[model samples]
Target: MPRLLGVDIPADRPTIISLTYLYGVGEKTARELCHKAGVNPQARARDLQEDEVARIAALLDKDYTVEGQLRRQVSQNISRLRDIASYRGMRHRRGLPVRGQRTKTNARTRKGPKKTVAGKKGVKDLR
Candidate 1:
């Protein structure tokens, strides 16, 4: 395992794929990082030399906000929306869909489990 930005990247995977394990780094960003660091994207993480790892880490630290920082920034954005009481914020407050997704049928993931309601009793039961 190679440690980068406090995350351990899988050793057996190619450098391009392994770099994506770090938060805020997707496929394109990983490739760009490899290119900037002069590291071979096709090489396995386990095969990388210490200097190469250090170079990659240095590039990421200097040029990007990743991991904890990225997570905090995103959460802050959502909080700001909530504070402003926007339509989307209201949806978040209510735990409903915020992106115009219909709640009539397919929002089980956001709406949670079904709550059963009692149906009308039969005439025999009324007696």
Candidate 2:
């Protein structure tokens, strides 16, 4: 594995693909990084030379917000929303879907497992 910005990129994968393992880096950004760093996008990460790795790292540090920086930025945005009491922030704070997904069904991922209420069947039986 090639360590870039404190994250180990998979050595067996193409450099462009491996770059996606870094947070905030996707296919397009990876391609752009390769172009700017003069690194071969198709080259496996393990085959990269020290200078090439340094170039990539330097470019990332200078031009991109990634890894921990990106994570903190996103969390800060969410917290700002929460502080302002936005609807989306409320949803996030309540652990509910924030994208207007129907909660009538198929929201178990956010709502967690069902908490079934008892006594309905017993009331019907008594009647």
Candidate 3:
């Protein structure tokens, strides 16, 4: 197992893809990190020694605000939205569409499942 940013990468995957398991690192960032660390993109995590994993982790820690810092920043952004009472915040409060999307017929994803009205049962004499 290769550990980076305190998260372990499964030895089964290639080194490039495995690094994406980190909080802020994605495919592009992973590739960049691999390039920076002098690690082969096709290399497997299991093939790497602890020092190599440490190097990548150190690189990320030195250069980026991930881990705890990112979480705090994201939380602060959400808090700002809530504090402002803006349209987006109002939409959040109401559970309605927020991003200027037409909700007349669409936006079923955020609105959740539609409720079907019950039809009249069979009636005699058209009553």
TM-score of each: 0.80, 0.86, 0.72
| lDDT, candidates in the order shown | 0.92, 0.94, 0.83
Deviation in angstroms for 72 in model 2?
Answer: 0.9
| Clash totals in order | 0, 0, 0
Candidate 2 has a TM-score of 0.86
Query: Deviation in angstroms for 6 in model 2?
Result: 1.4
Better of 2 and 3 by lDDT: 2
Model 1 lDDT per residue over 1-127, tens place: 9999789999999999999999999999999999999999999999999999999999888999999889999989888999999998889887788899999988999877865658844647555
Candidates arranged by TM-score, highest first: 2, 1, 3
Clashing pairs in 1: none
Best by lDDT: 2
- Selected candidate, larger TM-score, 1 vs 2: 2
- Most TM-score-accurate candidate: 2
* Tens digit per residue, CA lDDT, model 3, 1-127: 8776677788999999998888787999999988998989898889987778878888998987776778889878767887899878778766787788888987898877875558865767955
RMSD of each: 4.1, 2.8, 5.1
- Looking at candidate 3, the ten consecutive residues that score lowest on lDDT are 115-124
